[model samples]
Target chain A: MKTNNGSSRAYSITSILILIILAILFLFPLYWILTGALKTPAAINSAVPQWWPQEFTLRNFEVLFSKRSAPLFEIGSLTGPIIPGAIRWLINTVFMAVLAMLLTCITASLAGYALAKKRFAGRVILFSLIVAAMALPKQVILIPLIKEMSALGLYDNLWAVILPTVGWPFGVFLMKQFAESIPGEMLEAARIDGAGELRTFITVVYPMIKPGVGALAIFTFISSWNDYFLQLIMLTSSSNLTISLGIATMQAENSTDYGLIMAGAALAAVPIIIVFLIFQKYFTKGITMGAVKG
Target chain B: MDKTLSPKLRRQENISGYLFLLPSLVFFLAFVVYPMVMCIWTSFTDANMNSNTADHFIFLDNYIELWKDPVFLKALVNTLIIVFVSVPIVCIFSLWVASVIHKMKEGPLSFFRIVFYLPVVTGSVAVTVVWKWMYNNYYGIFNYVLKSTGVIDKNINWLGDSKFALWCIIIILLTTSVGQPIVLYVSALSNVDHSLVEASQVDGATNTQVFWRICWPQIMPTTLYILVITTINSFQCFALIQLLTSGGPNYATETVMYYIYYTAFKLYRFGYGNAMGVILAIFIAILSAVQFRLAKEK
Candidate 1:
């Protein structure tokens, strides 16, 4: 028994040590991006790689910002002041993520509440359809979606990306899981007291599922921000590009400009990384909950 | 629960339910359902960028041609290789990581989870571009590190070479893929009935025996879920191939999903792209179904 305990203890210690080493290796890419962005051009292209920047400069960012320019804000003829195109891309990305999140939460919570609490005709069929749709690859529909967007005069619009993301069924499915935890009797009480459906949802259902909404909100935001393929296909104009798309186009144009590309990469990655770190608890919950019940 | 509802109450329930679902239903129908139906329908016609008037019915010509097309077949094979190689590696790696971390202190556990997940949250474009620089033959850290470590005597054109390009792409795919499974597995592992494990341990069962006989069966669903999701993700790998190789070094890294995009946007073969999309969907469905069946038997 003593030998067994000792051997197992040694085993765990070795495994944990190995995992820590692996973790550092996993983190190296992000580290390289952050440091590489700040390195001098000569330092960046050096044959002998600098583990850390010998000389840090913001010149890469300066070059990135000056490479292209777009208006700060535009609404029809009322254009706002001009800004660096990178900044414009960042703003566009944040707007797209936020809008997608709000729309997803509002629509999903309402539908999920109904699916969980209300006994509707076609409920099973609708739920099954959602599950099936969720199973299929989302990219398969993009070909027709492109045509549909053009037909609706929304081609090359951020709304094209946001709308499809909102339409995904995962949020509704997650909200339904959260809603199932609400007591049926409480809903019954609300109905008996003459509370209308919307009121009950707003007053009772919304509060109960707030955590789920929070999870879904962050999930959708990060996903929308990083959905490069959709953004790549949907938005063509430089001014309309999201950060990921903008960075990609930049990389393509200046393939060997490692410092410039890394700067753009940092611009694309850092804000989303900050968001993930801040709400990581909820983000983790969202992922596990989606899978566990799914 | 529904047996006690009066007809009038049931009717009211239906109305209220539909009203609540109406908002989400509209978006889902318009964006998801409509596009999906159109994709299938367009696959049967010779649609193109200029087919704004009307696409003529071509029936199974697209699929028939796809079968004959060498590039599509190569892409199909590469996609399958990616899926087969990555899924098992992801599943096993995540399972091991989850098991290790699930027993750790709260701070350390979360740290490991976030570390694994960072690559995923770092938008694929950023990840792919950085990797592109790292694989550069002239000035990449990989070559430097490998040389210093005496692992290789010379530089490798990692992305530009046909032999290594697909594997390099797969490695990145694995990093992004493992994060979700780790989260799922950690939760699933923690949720395994500890009392059962304790009981088995007290019965003089070996640790490996207890894990296989007890925990493995219990977490089979999570494994199955991970399998299906990883398979789908691997099959749909697009952004990496697009930004990295553009399916080159002689189409070594071409995937079905990337080929679909190339055909539709670059080649103007909308019908051909849709046909490939249909086949990819069918492959995913069949794989998912098989996983479900296997899990049930176990």
Candidate 2:
């Protein structure tokens, strides 16, 4: 708050300079992905790192797209028309992340509202369980999850990833935190106005907790999209790969093809980064609010 | 908190609460809770990919065997080293960055937050692949930059050498890890009781004194939350390992989480993997409890 003192001002300038440098260092990988994606094979393979690409081309994207092909999607006995496998993987990733986000928001909001406002038997126990489940190492659940998913025929399916993500309980925990700030009097007034439970939630609670949902939605999308561990285990086939998984698989095969891999990396990262940038305010609020009373 | 549960109210509340909770509970119980329970149960049995015979209960065997297995022991040690090394570094580093930037104008503040967060939003695959290239023996940026600057003579296989492999992974882990803690701490610093800060400043307290004495305690909960998450993340460090080293040249970077995947998937030792999973969960639970206890004391 105090900027008048010369020594303090100098200290602030030094810190800001350091911050700017660190910020650039943090941003370097992303800059690499975009530039590397566009760089020629020669530039990528050179002993000298290209701080910036000398020349850019879409050849990497061309190579990436031409690498493989798959059906866009599949039903029980039906499949969509053939397309670039990378596009299919992008479709799969989007589908998984979107479905997971929608389902988590819907379920977590309902459950979170209940945990926050309702007086019910075993509510404490249930709330406690949700918090504990949030902390449980996914490695624990994932081992049996593989078996359970295979048993339920969800293995190698997008639902295998989506269902577990929906069930993860972090969204519920976050939403409950947001919901707790809603005044009880407001809920009581809505009930007195003859609003049904669902109606009261839709009319009153939803508007207030939208920011929390925004936060959860953005994160759930990013996490599920980047959930390579789950995707690697649950999804095995080439055609069923998520974008990130597809890129990783591509790298494993063409290890030294840095341009192609960087293209794939760019494809995997750009849209989510855009989404994060758009909703970052809500995302920050959700993160801070969720940790406030913890 | 003020609401009282009369019998009539309790019944109505029960119905409505359970109704609201139904959809989430269905998925939670079926996927998360069931798998967790199954993980514990299977850990006590000799389950494998071979399904000719049913899994038989062999109580306490997997836990005992894990202690005797050197690889498992090594993985456990590696996991702990990552957690112990990365958690404090992340917390302190993030706190520093957050404190520095919290006072910045909105434009620059958002820019810093977004920058620090870019690696995370970029997803692990992209980040890992690029880092892999950077650490490559021949054309990697690290080797090129270092050799030119006279840091070392010959090219070092960053991810291949046991000496530098684990630390390299930890450095990448540190970058990804700081994003959230920084975000959390920035918000926490901004939200600190402003009056306390101003009062200390008026009393001629230095910036460092205010940060350490007033601001730090106020942000303790945020710090603790970040601590718990960073610990869990460091514990669950898998994708980077799976993509980068696959536990590498000499099992140098083998973490417990990676080992579990290797045991269950590649080797098909499902029971043993589940046991390791159970142990991992226990370790996390214990550490979180300890963190909460330590935080409570302050």
Candidate 3:
């Protein structure tokens, strides 16, 4: 019994050490960004890489809010002239992300319900297509997608950015998985009691799958919020740029302002972190839902 | 309920399902499936951006030319390197962390799981910015740690050097950003038949033996899922690279996605870009098909 206790104690100690290391590894980046955001530009770029800032100032934030500075980065093509407005870009990003999330959730829920509950022709083909689409690297369609966008006169527009991503296969797939678990007996009863399919979806199915929708909302929000390339390509005008584009522009305009750049990055990250915290349970449930269903 | 007795009404109820799916189907066909088909067709044509002349079809010309394009070849090499280096490392590290969480009894272990998963929430832009700072040569935290620990005498240029930049980025890739794998592994572990474990223990099998022999086989499907997703993700990787390096130091870090973006947008070579895009689609399709086949076979 004593030997067994000793073995367990050893195991516990090893586990603790591993946990601490992983924690530090995970937390260090956020801590660095927070600290870097707070530091003066000079302090940030200094040779020693100080653990603590010598002087803390909100200068970076002030600069971001200030109108005196020139545009952060050139609009398009490396050789393009600098366009001085960054505020519009940030606003556009916010609008695009929110809109995309709203659209993705509604469509995914509707389609997912159809796929899960109702038997229809080509259902297997549609489901398989969605699964395949989920696995597809976005790079595969980017070039032609761009051309098509241009032809449709939606190129360099926020709609272009939002439209392509709204039909996400993963979202549909997640909703289907969640919807599948909703007991068919309840739906049948709803039908028997005079609830139409859409009405049943709104009242019964939607509430039952709120957890799944919440998870999908968070996922779509994060993906759209973090998206860089599509926005970079589609939003050719600086005034229409997203946060990612704005940050990229900072590199070109003044790569030397490490503090300023880090500040922008922190700002970009705030919404995602907030959403994740609020939906943490949903997020975890979503993963398990996806894994098992797949 | 008797209202549904009519044949027309029955047809309408069935049609509602299709109606509900209409929006997604339209978008999918327009944005996904159509572009996919067009990409293949465009690859064979001498397609250029903003041209008045119709596309001149030159069968297999683009592919033949692409085979010789040093940049495409280099991009392919860089992408493969990221995949081969990052996937196994992330998998092993994630499994180790998951196993650790599995061993712990709820309190600290749950917190550890959250910590490991924190990166998944922070978004790629934040991750990229933080890593860029860490990878900075002279004053970066990474260099400072290495130098202070006496592991190296001087700072090693991480993102600056062509050879080290890709590898440096790979380390960041391997960090296993969210608690995704851990949760999956936990579920998989739970689903394992406890009797099998008990029998092994009764047979005097070591903990490691029980894990390898019983747990591993049970979770093989999850492992394959992770493998496929990670592989596809590695290929799709661009935001972080674009943010940190911008495919800089002479296109050293350019992946196919970045290449396609630049080719189409920056250079305005839309047709050529489409051609490259088709190549990518085929590559991913084949790879994913192979993955599904392998998983099924097992």
Candidate 4:
């Protein structure tokens, strides 16, 4: 018994040490991006890699901002003052993510509730189609989606990205998992009081599913923000480009300008990373809930 | 759970249900279902970016050409290699990480989870570009660190060489991929039935035996989930290749996803690209079905 206990303790200590090392390895890239963004060009291009910036400078960011310019906001004939293109890209990304989140939450919660609680016709078939679609690669449908967007005169628009993201079935499936737990008795009691369907959903059901909505909201936001492939395909104009796409195009133009590119990367990554850190609990719950019930 | 409803009650339920579903159905049908159907139909026609005339039906022509195209074949093989290698590694790695940290105090557990997840939230372009710097021919920390540690005497152009390029991509892919699985595994592990574990331990089962016999079976569903998601994620690896290598070094890192992008967007061969997309979808569907079958048998 003594020998067994000793061996188990030894095993745990070694494993914990390995986990710490692995955690650092995982974090190194973000660290590199942040530090590389602040490093001087000489340090960036030196033969000896600097683990930390020896001379911190904002020259990279200045150069990035100076590369191009776009209007801050556009409202038909009225446009906001021109700003650095990187800032414009950042604003475009935030708008895209927020709109996608809102749309997905509203649509998915309603559909998910019906699938879980309402005895609707074609429920099984609709739910099955959703599951099947979720399993297939979303990229497979992009070609047709592009042509369809163009036909609707939405091609090269942020909506082309936002609408497809909203249409993804994962959010609906996740809400259904959450909706399944709503007490049937509560819903029945609401109905007994002669409450209409919308009234009951708004007052009772919405409160119950708020946490699930929170999770889905954050999930949709992060995904739409980092959905580089869709953003790359859908938006082509320099002003319409998301920050990720902007940085990618910049990388293509100046492959070896590590400092400037890293600055752009930092700008693109930091906002989403901050959001992820703040709402990580919901994000984690959203991921596990989607998988566990499926 | 079903209870018999009166005729009026059934009608009321149907109306309410369809009302609730209407908003989502509109978007789903317009964006998802329509695009999917059109994707299949377009794969059989001679569609291109510059063609204004109606696309003529050329059934099976694109599919036949895809099978004969060496670039497509190479991309398919590379994609398979990525999926097969990353899925098992990610599963085992996350399982180990989760089992270790699930026993830790709350503060440390969340810290580890957040640390691992940072890469994923960092955005692919940022992550890929940073990695591009690390794999650079000169001034890359990887070469500097390895050389200082006496691991290698000369600088190795990691991404410029075909032999090492795919492996480097896979390594970066694994880092981004494992975060969610670890979260899932940790939750799954904690939810395992402790009663059974105690019973086995009371009967003098060894640690390994308890894990293999009791804990493993209970978490098989989570394992299967991780496997499928990781496989899909690996197969869709595009931004990394596009940013870092652009499927170069002699197409060593070409993947079906990237090739589809190249064909449709770059070459404007919409029909051919849609054909590849169809094949890719079929491949994923078959693999997912096989996984489900294997899991069910177990």
Measured against the native two-chain assembly using Cα atoms, what DockQ does each of the candidate structures obtain, in the order listed?
0.90, 0.79, 0.51, 0.86
Going through the candidates in order, what fraction of the true interface contacts does each contain? 0.88, 0.90, 0.58, 0.83
Which rank order by TM-score, best down to worst?
1, 4, 2, 3
**Residue B23 C-alpha lDDT in model 4:** 85
lDDT string for model 3 (A234-276, tens) is 7776566777677777766776677887787777776667777
True contacts kept of 4: 0.83
Model 3 misplaced stretches (Cα beyond 4 Å): A1-9, A67-88, B1-10, B103-110, B176-179, B293-298
lDDT of 1 at B213: 97
Q: Docking category for candidate 2?
A: medium
- What tens-digit string does per-residue lDDT give for candidate 4 at B187-221? 99999999999998889898999999999999999
Grade the docking of candidate 1. Answer: high
Error of 2 at B224 (Å): 0.9
Q: Model 2 over residues A1-294: C-alpha lDDT tens digits?
A: 445477788988898899889988888888888999999999999999888999999999999999999987788779889999999999999999999999999999999999998888898999889888888877668878888898898889889999999999888899999899899899989978999989999999999898899888888888888888889899989899999999999999999999999999999999999989899898887777777663
List the pairs of residues colliding in candidate 4: none
DockQ of 2: 0.79
Summing lDDT over every window of 10 consecutive residues in candidate 1 chain B, give the lowest-scoring window: B47-56
Enumerate clash totals for all models, in the order shown: 0, 0, 2, 0
Chain B TM-score against the true chain B, candidate 1: 0.98
Question: How many angstroms is residue A162 displaced in model 3 relative to the true structure, after the best TM-score fit?
Answer: 1.1
Q: Which whole-number lDDT from 0 to 100 does residue B38 have in model 3?
A: 81
Off by over 4 Å in 2: A1-4, B1-9
Model 1 error, position B230 (Å): 0.5
lDDT of 1 by residue, B103-124 (tens): 9899999999999999999989
* Residue-level error in angstroms, candidate 3, position B51: 4.3
Candidate 3 C-alpha lDDT tens digits along B1-298: 5354477756765698798898878877788778777888888887777658798988888788888989988888888888878777767777777776776677666677667777766667677877887888866888888888899898888898987888777777666443677777766777888999999888977667888999988888878777777777777778777777867678899887778877877787766777777777677677767887887887
